[model samples]
Target: MVTIQGIAFIPQNISKGGEKLYILNKQDVPIVDGLINLNSDSSQANLSEAQQQLDLLWNKLDLIEMNDELKAISPAMAQGKIDKRLIIVHRYIRLNYGEPLTLQLLADLINCNPVYLSNTYTKLFKITPMKYLQVTRMKKASELLKETNMSIKDITTHLGYVNNSQFSTIFKRYFSCTPVEYRRNQHLQMRSIGIF
Candidate 1:
């Protein structure tokens, strides 16, 4: 699953800890419809679904380029880029998502005012830093679920959640499926593609 921003790429794998595992950018860059796996293992009927999705996305992006007058310019160009503040926030989210981090705590760590951090993050990411951290945690948890056999309780404790309930709630909310469901899907996918 992809997030609101295209930069993050969450794979089908779910962590035993109930977080979403992100794909490496080198193997999968954040292009349009990049979530469409080129080698999806999910139990979907077609193994080539990912490739087809990629072709469709590429065509759509191509059409937009062809129709727009900006063809002379680089369609790959990024405009309205984020500032350094957002970069710091993203880094913080990556580094501390599994920890019991608070906004105030992050502000203090970064030597910025909490309000300023909140405002900047909201303006740029369209979500608070906490939300980003939650997403990050979920992503990592999903990865663990797919790649490891650690118990669910162990995953929850590792992520620093108060208990399994909190972890389940967040995991369910984001994935629209329980951690187990996500894991099952990943297992089926892996088996279908002979990854297991």
Candidate 2:
């Protein structure tokens, strides 16, 4: 699973060396949620059901990304396919987004020059590494706001922001609403759907 610009994609490699990335929207989130729930059953029937759900997810996804997007996502075949370091950095971001991260820190992880890392990352990902990190944190913030009882003040520190005001500013910019407002709306929606 990969998320960019508030969208999640389930990327599957083709039979050969290439890959096809299926773009999933907010509406397809249930497919992922169901997949997680179905994963715990450990039965043949559940496995079949899980496979059907995956098929349904694939059916619901949009087509492969455009050439420009694919280019940003992957380097040319001549450049040794994809950079291993970038993959490491991306995976690191997904795992540790709650912590404070800087370009120098990310570059130090792979023993590369900071400027080179930033430039190459943007060329490959179409966004600066820090921007990627912010988006990642915002995504996690939304999940926490909706699913956890942690107060907004605590969530601010948990997400590595200096204070509530800063977190609120960024959250509002990202979601067009304060964190509390987003959480309330999410709860209302969930209640309406009989999930709460």
Candidate 3:
């Protein structure tokens, strides 16, 4: 007789994947037990229950099928499909510029291979994720420089830079001036234009 072993309840963790559930037996670990993802609209309390529900659901989904109208829009549908995932990853990186956002973390969040994600992201956006992150940090640094009187060390720490020297080098490379010079120039330019 089949016995219920163990259970694993993985919530709707987007960083792990889409909405998915994994169940294992006493001997089977969560990672090894395999998973049954609730793709459409159905519930899987258990494996046999999941199989039964999915089989019925598949038939229903197949009956509706894709028509000529849907076929014509397949590319659009596919583009939209990937675009949402891409936007989510991009926005997360933009919003978490001060965090240690490693490539592995981003890959897990977006549910793709790190190398593939890196290559595809670079191809689609014309920049690597690290490069994008660096630019994002620089943007934040620029905003702080223009708006606040924070010290160089403070800006460096706020931007998650390892040290002031690294921050200053990148800041200079991007703005053609050191942080101090950049901040000074920004203030003088704003005052000259009555922007302050």
Comparison by lDDT, 2 against 3, better one: 2
Tens-place lDDT digits, model 2, residues 110-189: 99999988888887787789998898789789878986899999899888888899999999998899999999999998
Q: Give the Cα error of residue 74 in candidate 3, in Å.
A: 13
Question: Candidate 1, residue 139: CA error in Å?
Answer: 0.9
The alpha-carbon deviation from the true structure for residue 145 of candidate 1, after best TM-score superposition, in angstroms, is 0.9
Tell me the whole-model lDDT of each prediction, alpha carbons only. Answer: 0.66, 0.76, 0.66
- Tens-place lDDT per residue, model 1, 36-62, is 443445555544566466455545433
What tens digits encode model 3's per-residue C-alpha lDDT throughout 47-73?
455456545543433232213224534
Local error of candidate 3 at residue 157 (angstroms): 1.3
Total clashes, candidate 3?
0
- In candidate 3, which residue pairs clash? none
TM-score of every prediction relative to native? 0.56, 0.63, 0.56
Q: How far is 165's C-alpha from truth in model 3 (Å)?
A: 0.9
Report how far residue 129 has shifted in candidate 2, in Å.
0.3
Error of 2 at 5 (Å): 25
